[model samples]
Target: MKKFIIAPSVLSANYMNLKNDLTQCLENDINWIHYDVMDYDFVPNLTFGSKILQDITSQIKMNIDIHFMVKVKTKNFTDFFVEYIKANPQMMTMHIESMNAKETKLFIDLCKKNNIKASLAVSPQTPIKKIIKYLPIIDNILVMTVEPGFGGQSFIEHAAGKIGLLRKIIDQNNYKTTIEVDGGINSETSKIVKDYGVDIIVAGSYLFGQKDFAQRAKKLAGGN
Candidate 1:
């Protein structure tokens, strides 16, 4: 079995003490940080951008897993992509619904040029087959267990099937790709995803909402 990674999403962290929250994760031996970049147009909520990401990464040396929740057709989408790429996150995931074939290839190529792992994200309602063609090229696939817009939602149980199918496809093709799941992930949901072959777990409210982040993180990572 693959060792599951516990990535605490900064979206649910206390904004005023963001640095402390992130540092706490590192202190607890958790290395991956899930950063959600939302542009009000694609999703209903708007989130922080590259400058903030740079600031956090400068202070804390953690593996940054950025999820881009924005529309590709937006006027400044490229600008946003370039700026984020400059931050040099370990991995970056863009929504499959936002880009077409050409745009997807362009995004993946940019990540390769910069030596950053590129990933495709699929919403809860999206079919698993939507990203099959790109599986061999991308480094990872982020399966959203809940709707993309907000956090603290219940896990969509049916998404587990998608995770299973993705794992089978990756194994059958011997692709060097990983599977990551985000949104509404708690201790229970973590088990479900892990059983289905999720390599990384992105937990927002469930991990950050409680006072004991380390304890929650350990549980989510399948540690006792």
Candidate 2:
């Protein structure tokens, strides 16, 4: 079995003491940080951009996973993509629901050219069929467990089915795509996601809301 990744979503970390919280996560042996990038147009919210990501990247040794929840619009989208590539995250994912097939391929190729592992994400309502063709090129697939844009929404129970279907498609194609689950991933939801062959579990409030982060990390990483 693949060692499941317990990636704490930085969106839920206290922004006032963000660096310290990040350092705490590192000290607790949690090595992956999930960055949820949202643009108000695409997801009804605005979030950190390249500058903040650069600051965090400079400060930590942990792997950074950038989840782009923005629609591809204007030349600015390409500019931001360049900035994200420069930030050099371990993985950079964009939503398939936001772009056409050609654009998705272009961005994935762009990430590959920059040596970043490219990923494609889909919302709860998006069908696996939308991204299945891109599976051969994408290194990972993020299945949103809740509607995108927010941090603390409840996990859509049926999202597990999406992950399971994705797992099957990946296996059938013999592709080495890492399946990731985000949103509403507490200890209980973690089990369901893991059972569906999810490789990375992105937890936000469940990991950061508590004072005992170390224990929370352990529980999130421990699956049946």
Candidate 3:
């Protein structure tokens, strides 16, 4: 069986002790430390940037996975993020829907040149086909269960079919890309999602919000 990578998203971490919060993710054997780098243009909420990543790189040992939830601009932040990747970033990516086709390709190519793992995400409302058009250029697909920006929303049931369809498309086309599912991925629902064959699970509220945060994260890691 393929290994299930557990990436604990840090959007819900306590800002006061963000480094300490990341320390817990390191303790749990989580696969990657996910950063939700959002700008207000793409989504309603805006999240932290290189300042937070600087703190994380100075302290943590786990692999870094960046989800750039920002609108495509004059390569300002992307230039900053390329600098982040230079500091040994394991995975750095941006939103496909946030930029136009030409820009998306350019961004992915830039990330690849910088040796940062490139990925793209889609909201529950966007068609998976739009994402597939860019698949040959990207490395992973972040399929959202809940809407971006905020957590604590119910998982949309309709997304299950989309996941299954994406799986078929990936396999048939021989794409070596990972299928990552974020939001609402708890132990119970995660097991159910096993049927859809996701490779990475990005857990946010489900991980950091728990009392026994480390063990709960390992539990969601699902049997090694």
> Per-residue lDDT for 1-224 in model 3, tens only?
56788888888788787777777776777648788888898888988877668767776677888887878566553564555665577787666678777777777887788777788888888899788877777888888888888766677767755778888889999998888888787777787566788888888888775798867876777653
What's the lDDT for residue 161 in model 1?
69
State the lDDT of candidate 1 residue by residue for 88-134, as single tens digits: 79999999998888788888988898899999999989998889999
* Candidate that beats the other on lDDT, 2 or 3, i.e. the better one: 2
What lDDT would each prediction earn against the true structure? 0.87, 0.87, 0.77
* CA shift of 4, model 2, Å: 0.7
Residue 136 alpha-carbon offset, candidate 1, angstroms: 0.6
What overall lDDT, based on C-alpha atoms, would model 2 receive against the true structure?
A: 0.87
- Show where candidate 2 strays beyond 4 Å: none
The most accurate candidate by TM-score is: 2
How many clashing residue pairs, candidate 2?
Answer: 0
Q: Model 2 over residues 22-132: C-alpha lDDT tens digits? A: 988888778899998999988999988888988888877889999999887766446668776667799999999888777887888888888888999989998898888
Candidate 1: the clashing residue pairs are none
Which residue pairs clash within candidate 3?
none
**TM-scores across all candidates?**
0.95, 0.96, 0.91
